[model samples]
Target chain A: MQPVYEVHKLSKYYGRIRALDHLDLALAPGKLVGLLGPNGSGKTTLIKIGAGLLTPDQGSVLIGGMAPGPATKAIVSYLPDRMALPTEMTTKDVVSMYSDFFADFDRVKAQEMLRDLHLSDSQRIGSMSKGTQEKVQLCLVMSRAAKLYLLDEPLGGVDPAAREYILSTILRNYSEDSAVLFSTHLISDIEKVLDEVAILRQGKLLLHDSVDHLRQEKGMSVDEFFKEVFRC
Target chain B: MNWNITAGRPVYVQLIEQLELAIVTGEYPPGSRIPAVRELAAEAGVNPNTMQRALQDLESRGLLQSQRTSGRIVSANQDTLHTLRVQRAEVYVADFLRQMHKLGYTQEETLELLQKATFPTVSNTKEES
Candidate 1:
């Protein structure tokens, strides 16, 4: 099967600083891949490239065999690290907007998830707390039956219970024909749920392997192995 | 079943171990249909793909069988179950013997210690029975 997302010798620079340095990564469908790295290791940059928010300085990224463009965007569901929803819009409005923007959006599933999260449809985005907004955004993103999911920092700033809820939601939406690339710093919480992990260091692809193979080879949890690899 | 997945090992390997334990203990009795992969994955709080891999491994081992009508059922073969039980026991006994060796106790000494040891709860259960 072709990789749902592919990057080859990808590089990006911010003036003089290199955000990504010749990174090569490919994500197969049916796998939940954890994009792990310390801050400034180019995790967000990589994800942004995949989401087509920013073009890479060099190399290529393919989403479903096409470059990140209108065609790929139609099939990619992205949850940005920060809140992108307008504060004035109510949850219902956002659901409608998403449904209009993406044909694959599942409004019913999104509403169901919002209700389960105790987020009323009438609640305005701006009035809700940061964590709630993130949850809402995640609900909207995961509710889409996209071919690829690019979730950047989905676990950031959420309480432990919310984190558990988010993980469960991801697991529940998992499909063999699609893939989820979740980038976050919280390795311990999500490592067990990942099929594979791709670790970056200093804008380089440090390692990528199945979680179990990593553990069996390193004799340590993904968290411990990451710490060991990134230890200063 | 309470699925406890610890760190430092492969998730599927742990799932296989736990699922085997569930089967051998009759928690998933022989010939009983098992839960769907998604259900098991959600219950264990692990990835569905990982759970499916573990289940496939068990199926290949003859501990589980897939029927056209039923999704997956625990193997009803007593011989297979007995062999698996004996295999698990041998692993435990090997580990015990290795530990005794590390403590400078010979096999005879370990057996003697085992014979001499008594558990109040086990003794009470025996008396009650």
Candidate 2:
């Protein structure tokens, strides 16, 4: 399989602090890889690089054999942990903006998803609760038929029911041809859906393998292996 | 099917090994219905994904069969189960015999210990200990 996202000796710095150090990764296509790490482990940094939202100071990053550019961004869909929607805009307006910006954005699907969510098109984002706004954000991201899906802390800080809804929506909207990279610390809940995983620690790659293969090789639970390998 | 357990190395293989035992020991006897993913997950207190993976692994090995209506079931033919049991028994017996040798016990003594320890007729099994 061709590596969809390839990086070699990738490094990033924010002023004096080294965010990512000599990171090397080659991701195969058709995978839902969990990026596992605690806070400040560069999970967010790596995701930002992948989403083309941030640039690496050193080394090269490629998406489908191309540098992170407009073409790459067109095929990648990103859903940040926090809601960034304009509070003044209505749900329909958000859909329209996404449709205008991304050619791959399917407005019909977006409208259908909004209908399924039972949220009225006239509902202003500011009028809805934070969790409901998250649902709207999720609906917008999933509306695009992109090759790569970067979901950063999608379930973070959400309530239980919202968490469930978000997870199910993610699963339901996933396409077999596309790859979804979800970065979060909620390993226990999402580990099942993950076909593969890349565990990051202290801004470095620790382990990357199929969930099934890892279990077969380690002969322990992923949770246990994680504890042992990352013992503090 | 869903499992709640964290699926990973050695653990997934261990679950597979255990399921194989059940198949061989008639706990999940040949031609008998096997537990659904949720049922097995709850029984094991594992994530339903783990059970689904285990079932998938079993199906791939051809030791278990799956149907749309009945879900997963034990394979009617016991050939695969029988071979697996023999393979595992060899390793376990080898380990037991090696441990006995390390403890300065002879083969005869090891057999005697096995005979006494696992004797099925010993209904009050752990009481003697």
Candidate 3:
């Protein structure tokens, strides 16, 4: 089967700074891969390239055998690391917008998840707490029945309780028919839910291996292995 | 059930051990159907694929059986269940002995300590006379 997301010798640059340097990675369907890297390591760059928001300077990124384009964009669900939703929009309005934009969007699932979180339809995005906004974004992102999900820092800035809720939501929504590549710094918190990890260093692919394989081979959890690899 | 996954160890290995414990303790009794992989994975807060791996491992060990119509079920064989229970207990026994050895307790000393101990109470009430 074709990989849900594939990158081959992908390189991107910001002027002289190398954002992605000869990086190669592939995500298979039915897997939740954690993309790990420290500051300026090109995690967001890689995600944006996969989301078709940015073009690579060299090499290629293919979403389900096609390059990231209008075709790939139709089947890709992206959640930017920062707040990207219109603040003036109410929760109900955002749900309606997603439903209108994505043919695969499940409005009922999004509304049910929002209700479960006690986020009312009338609540405006700008008025909600930072954590609530993150939850709202996640609810919409996961509600889509996309082929591949590119989530940048989905767990950032959320409290521990909210983090658990977010993780559970991800687990519940994940299916063997789709793939999710999520980038985050909270490794230990999200470690258990990941099938594999792709670690990057200075825009280079450091390592990509199954989480259990890493633990069995290195005799440490993925978080520990990640720390040992990137330790100062 | 509380998964109690720890760092350093492989999560799926922990999952396998916990699922084995659940089977041996009758939490998932003999011949009883188990929840779907997604449901169990969500409950444990781990990936569905990892949970599927753990369940498949149990199936390989004869502790679980997957049926075409009823989903996965705990093994109905009493002998297999009993042996599994004994094996799990022996692991704890071996660990206890190893710890006692680290503390410089001889086998005889450890045996005597076991004799004087009352489990479930978790307190050493034997008076030194």
In lDDT terms, which candidate is top?
Answer: 1
| Best of the candidates, TM-score | 3
Q: How high a TM-score does candidate 1 get? A: 0.87
| Best-to-worst ranking by lDDT | 1, 3, 2
Model 3: lDDT of residue A142: 89
- The superposed Cα distance between candidate 3 and the true structure at residue A117, in angstroms, equals 2.0
**lDDT scores of the candidates, listed in order:** 0.91, 0.79, 0.90
Higher-lDDT candidate of 1 and 2:
1
> Local error of candidate 2 at A113, Å?
2.7
Writing each residue's lDDT as its tens digit, candidate 2 over A187-221 gives 77776667788888777888888887887788865
> Model 3 — TM-score against the truth?
0.92
Models 1 onward score TM values of: 0.87, 0.67, 0.92
- Which of the two, 1 or 3, has more DockQ? 3
State iRMS for model 1: 1.3
lDDT of 3 by residue, A1-232 (tens): 7899999999999999999999999999999999999989999999999899899999988999998888998899999998888999999999999999899999999999988888889998999988889889989998999999999998898878777888888888888878999999999988999999999999999899998888889888787887888889
lDDT of model number 1? 0.91
What stretches of model 1 exceed 4 Å from their correct place?
A: B68-70, B86-129
- Assess the local accuracy of residue A196 in candidate 1 as a C-alpha lDDT between 0 and 100: 94
Query: Residue A78 error for model 3, in Å?
Result: 1.1
Off by over 4 Å in 3: B104-116, B119-129
